[model samples]
Target: MTDDLLLTGARVLDPGGGRSGRYDVAVRGGRIAAVGADLPHRDARHVVDLRGKLLTPGLVDLHTHVYAGATYWGIHPDPVAWYSGVTTWVDAGSAGAYSIEAFRRAIRDFRVRVPVLLNISAVGLTGRTGESRDLENCDVDLAVATVADNRDLVAGIKVRVDRETVGRHGTEPLRRGVEVAAACGLPVMVHIGTTPPRLADVLALLRPGDIVTHCASAIAAAADGGGPVSPALREAHAAGVLLDIGHGSGGFAFDVLEAQLAAGLTPYSVSSDLHARCLYGPAFDLPTTMAKLLAVGLTLDEVVAAATVRPARALRLPDGIGTLTPGAPADLAVFTVEDGPFELVDAHRQRRYAPRRLVNDATYVAGRLLPPRLPEPPRPWIPLTAAQRQALQRRAGTVRALLTAPLVGPEGLAEQFPRQQAAVPLDPAAAVREPVADPVSEEG
Candidate 1:
């Protein structure tokens, strides 16, 4: 039997390992076997020619909401992963101690890897906001126990400190979440926006390894919504806090990103805060989000690192997560670099253009190519323009027509069962014989 799958002739880019250039990758037994020049494909079961394509580690989204069916923000990752090249979907704060078992049950069916930053609020994001309003829901001891119970799934703790989510409670929720993190020895991922607790106050609570998910959010940029970045944000960047682009429906803006970039405060990771609301526009997918960084003048290598290696290291996801190195899981993405003065938009509809973008050609998880899946329509609560709604309806219609239509014309199909072998004799009365049924011999 053939033992390997060889992929050749791609501009291999492994930003995590600092390896880039013309390279061929080999996969054997669902793990990367080798990566170098002239890999022999003679004995490989499958060999794909990937000339003029860009190959990199399967993307790891540091922030996303994938606890589908149970959470207000949840959207299944598999539907997007097959087409978007995101292999690791980090479900950020979609579930908490109260709903973790259900979250686990939901994720059990996912094809991609899903690690969670359990929410500080026991209710999780079952609603759009107010999860942290009730202080009783923010029980620290219970959270620590929940993490203990689900140690393998829980990577860190998440707290949403905002006007709507925390109400008058302010950063008290953030403090409790920090306590939980301190006990668990896990980093806290704080969602910063809509200050009652100022952005400065929020940044102050975060330690070196903790993360600020929507660091480029216009909602928290400054009081006036545009200008120089606050000194607090600069201090946090200097103090080693990781800035992640959680480009959700309302979580990002070009002005803020540009300001941060100009201030030498590059995002440590790039993640599509993909959910029911943002899945369609603004934050379509991780690659699109990466392209926005490119539009902002970041090199492909830097953007790739932010999407892959940097996030993987920040989260300490398993060793092989964001690389194509030998012995790592053979999870990878292949893309065609398309020339495009592509119109890009941030969470607020701020516009920019990218000269080139990565269009996904294939996504593989553990050496097996993932099958296509269409995403569901937006949830009822999600606000969309009439044009956007029309587009979705049109898309649904097209998909329905495509699926309902015959897969091929007569010329495109071949018959597997021929008439000659299955035909009954015309002169059955004259020469009919019964065939024996076997049950080791004849049925008794």
Candidate 2:
């Protein structure tokens, strides 16, 4: 209830400084007052026990579409933010000069910190194909003016270099995006997938601080046919081009990611390209994307750094936003690492079982304590119509026979019938339920 609060007994992990230990963090007037084990909570009006939780800087998602009701692929930020341990949502090219005012209006009352990347295209992502196909839409002067007008909210420029988005324009759109970013003295975050100008060409044009998102996309061609970790990419990384994992529905591929990691090409930041389509499956949330990285051999500390400190530095966000340092804003995420047989999926539909997953326990924004978004309570099975029940029984019987049949080993089970294995309930009666409407289908 009070602005001053004390979080005690948390395993404090500040990946920014490579510090990890149990500490008591005190907050007052929305800023961190002190952080140490012996800090007295006598002056604090509110005290929270975080004994079993890991407390780190508030998570930062560098790539997201939070312009809900404004963009077709956008979703509200708060629901995905607090729930996934993110306190900062960086809108990645969801709004351009045309819609940025609406985007700004939408987030004016939001609790989460929203910094936007102004799209190069004047229309942004309002169309079915994308915002950059027409050369007319790539208005450099308007974009530069927009960034100047909204200096506080605008972080950088965003451009998609994929073939489908840019069409015959090739790297011209990227050129315009870079020009606007240069004029505004900001970094440019380029999205690369199916490339006509090639990923190497995109990389060559980017400056040191510029970011190439979806670096692990399988659609990206290797510069020298060596592997997915192209020679140009390695050179670009050396020259300071930041590589970001914008794991959207079609961006991340397990094979490509594994190869890149194996070849020592670790991403500078990890972000869920959280839009409508990928929000449910594959790219579930920022935490899930981090879990996928964990599954692929990134250390817990490494993964935390990618989601926190690294992204903050990349976006040039104000200090104290991504660290639990004393005198910083009291934005924190408390999580518990659950031991698991947890199944994680990539954008390519490849599955990997992680030994552990970080589950958010609670979050604190500014100095306000917020509840973690909990899973919905299981609904009671709705009684099915007689015909529907009979159909379900028959379906269950067929599945049971297939699961028990010879040649359906563990490998075959996962490979051959992935969807059926995950979908079927053990009890046939439980399977005969009414379909629930998708929560995200309708506009807010």
TM-score of each: 0.93, 0.82
Tens-digit per-residue lDDT, 60-136, candidate 2: 99999877666667777676666678998899998889988988889897788999999999898875456788899
Could you give candidate 1's per-residue lDDT for residues 304-327 as a string of tens digits?
A: 999998888887888578988788
Mark the regions of model 2 whose C-alpha exceeds 4 Å error after superposition: 1-3, 222-226, 371-444
Compute the lDDT for candidate 1.
Answer: 0.90
Worst 10 residues of 2 by lDDT: 374-383
RMSD (Cα, Å) of candidate 2? 16.3
Candidate 1 least-lDDT 10 residues: 219-228
Clashing pairs in 2: none
Give the clashing pairs for model 1. Answer: none
Best by lDDT: 1
The superposed Cα distance between candidate 1 and the true structure at residue 248, in angstroms, equals 0.5
Cα deviation at 341, candidate 1, in Å, is 0.9
